[model samples]
Target chain A: MASKPECACGDTSAVAGGKKRIIFPCAGTANVGLISNAAAFQLADEGYGVATCIALLGSADTGLRRRIAEADEVVIIDGCPATCGAKIADLQGIAIDQHIVITALGIDKVYERNYTEEEVERVVSAAWEGKGRT
Target chain B: MKIEVLGTGCMKCKRLLKNVEVAVQELGIAAEIKKVDDITEIINRGVMLTPALAVDGEMKVSGRVADVKELKEILKG
Candidate 1:
């Protein structure tokens, strides 16, 4: 037996339109960076949020500020443990609903041809699962 | 080809720009490298990743800079 009621925040929101979901990717120069981008892309494709680069967020002329202010949910994907994406969001004072670190899961840091899309997808799913908890 | 490494001038972006230049020189290709710090233009490129490398008008790579050898291959292509 399962309940059929729908929730927007997966909690208690009824109307689900323009929730303004946004994802920030660290996009560093390592395996974790690629994973972060992959995860962000998947999240955006899944309609969880708009996938905007953290760098863009840091430099945009108040556009990033606007996105942060209007975003109902903000997700950050940082490669490795540096957490640059998270740091950027923190500096912007934007509360992140989901923060994902690929290397934190025991995956060795790498770049170039050593990384696989499957691993990135796994991390993205994990981030998605952790959503709305922030 | 004009290549631009887009980032907030982070170490990674700088490093990638260096690699791109090295590759271009090694391959004896004629290109100029530019660093873009404008967030609006970066976002306009629809790149959701930093340390992005653009070849000419196309985004050749993003998130990480490829190795010198790999960069050479990409540039040669």
Candidate 2:
């Protein structure tokens, strides 16, 4: 097994106010994952924090640790209640500013090809509005 | 054999599941493909990313969908 990434905590600088936004998507196996990806994309299209890979930011060999630690805010997107993104951030010792779970927002889990655009917008807007961010 | 298309039911998940079926048919493997939609259950297996593939309870891929060729190779191995 690949060892979990080593973590160094605390970003007092971003805490003081920075503009960098970090978004992470759990990208799980259902509509929730699609919803999260859609919302993240919409957020990016609307000029929110840049859309980058949560895995890239969570990398064990790169500067993901420092980037997340110093980010103005971190938006974690989990497809379902499993909250893979949120748990990963917590484990990595980085502070999570926001958390969005697709299934928690009323999207049912099913095997299908279509996604709900309205739901994606709502979730992304919620993340942008700082509903769960603390 | 139990084959799991690990995602929360996204397009990629559906696609991967379909591809898995195709690969299994081509390879003539009698595998039951299941969709793992529960985030908690998925993570309990130690996979934090989605759109993964697990065969017989062993995680093989995560965060992206594997094509038919790759799926065939994975199932063959």
Best by TM-score: 1
Candidate 1 displacement at residue A96 in angstroms: 1.6
- How far residue B36's Cα lies from its native spot in candidate 1, in Å, is 50
- Compared with the true structure, all predictions reach lDDT values of 0.68, 0.68
TM-scores, in order shown?
0.52, 0.52
lDDT of 2 by residue, A4-111 (tens): 321111211222121467777786657777777778877665435656676765565357767766666788888887788888777777788778777777788676
Off by over 4 Å in 2: A1-18, B1-77
Q: Predicted chain A of model 2: TM-score relative to the true chain A?
A: 0.77
TM-score of 1: 0.52
Writing each residue's lDDT as its tens digit, candidate 1 over A14-98 gives 2323245677888887777877787788766644567887887777549778857866777788777788888877777778877
RMSD of 1: 18.5
Per residue, candidate 2 scores C-alpha lDDT tens digits across B15-64 of 56777887899899898989988766666777655567899999886755
Per-prediction DockQ comes to: 0.01, 0.01
Clashing pairs in 1: A21-A49, A31-A110
